[model samples]
Target: EQKKNITYVLNGTTQIQSYVKQLIDVTKSWNCSDVTYTTVRLEDFFADIKEQALGLVEIYHQKIDWKAEQSDKKVTIAYDPMFRAVMNVIQNAVEHTKENGIIYIDAKEQDGRLTFIVEDSGSGFTKEALLHGTEQFFMDDTSRNGEAHYGMGLFFAKTVAEKYGGGIKLSNSENTGGARVEIFFLSSQETS
Candidate 1:
């Protein structure tokens, strides 16, 4: 039993290490302000993102209940960066949320705007995390050795949002009484 538990923890640690490497690669290549944007239909985009998020859920070994709608509406944005940014938020939730905690995602678009909200049933953000959570390398004191987190997840996500005239907000989820993050974009319309 000890061996199995050790192996499980090691596997989880390996997965996090891999993702951290991916995050580093993203930062090295990110030029969010100048990246090329792609226009995609909402339904297709949602489908693709949902699949990726689910993959993260499995990798992190957590159960998440996804809640999002389909739309024929169109959005023009940087696909890779935006996708990674959204995933970062979801990944943060997966990491901080307890082993059996429930995570929730709500994706939506309205009148040329798009938003992705992530919520969790874990201990929500600290008082400090709420104010400067999106700042680079702003990990809380409780962070493990400051190695597991460089505090770039939400920071990168917020940067991507601003690149496309959007923004991000960190708050406590009233319903779940846990951390909630909303990444949103505005004026994402294409001209005919």
Candidate 2:
């Protein structure tokens, strides 16, 4: 079934082909099983994520008003799965954002913890969504209307963050007027 879908896209219009290619690349990142923690540079991690975000924004037909900033930092982490988590949330942000919306990516390491933030310019999540958004299969209208979403993105992201001695925080971005999510990861030791 997935192959059929891929074939169809490959045979479709140029935009569809591009979107499918981006989708496949992003999909591959999610299947990473290497959970070991190792020292990694923050700039390298952000560069990878920003590239993925660029593909996602283009595929989603959003403008490239993206920004990424980080302080001088280095930390040990299972960056593969964490990259998947970051991509998933940024995709979610794109889904909720209006056309030509702005998305912001910021990160910093402070006091032995690394904090990654993604905020967008869309209708913020409802209060209920902010509270239960991380629950498995919990989709809300703002992020997942009648789409194929299983509501597992944020749930899996939270799980990954937690498994690494960190957690996720969701809230409305007062500045961007959209949903804001912060993923926190401890740099000291691996939890599992």
Candidate 1 off by > 4 Å: 1-34, 144-147, 190-192
TM-score, cand. 1: 0.80
Candidate 2 structure quality by residue, lDDT tens digits, 16-78: 555565455445544556355667677777788888888888876776454555534566777
Model 2 misplaced stretches (Cα beyond 4 Å): 1-34, 64-73, 141-146, 188-192
Which number leads on TM-score?
1
Clashing pairs in 1: none
- Cα distance off (Å), candidate 1, residue 94: 0.5
**True lDDT of residue 36, candidate 1:** 70
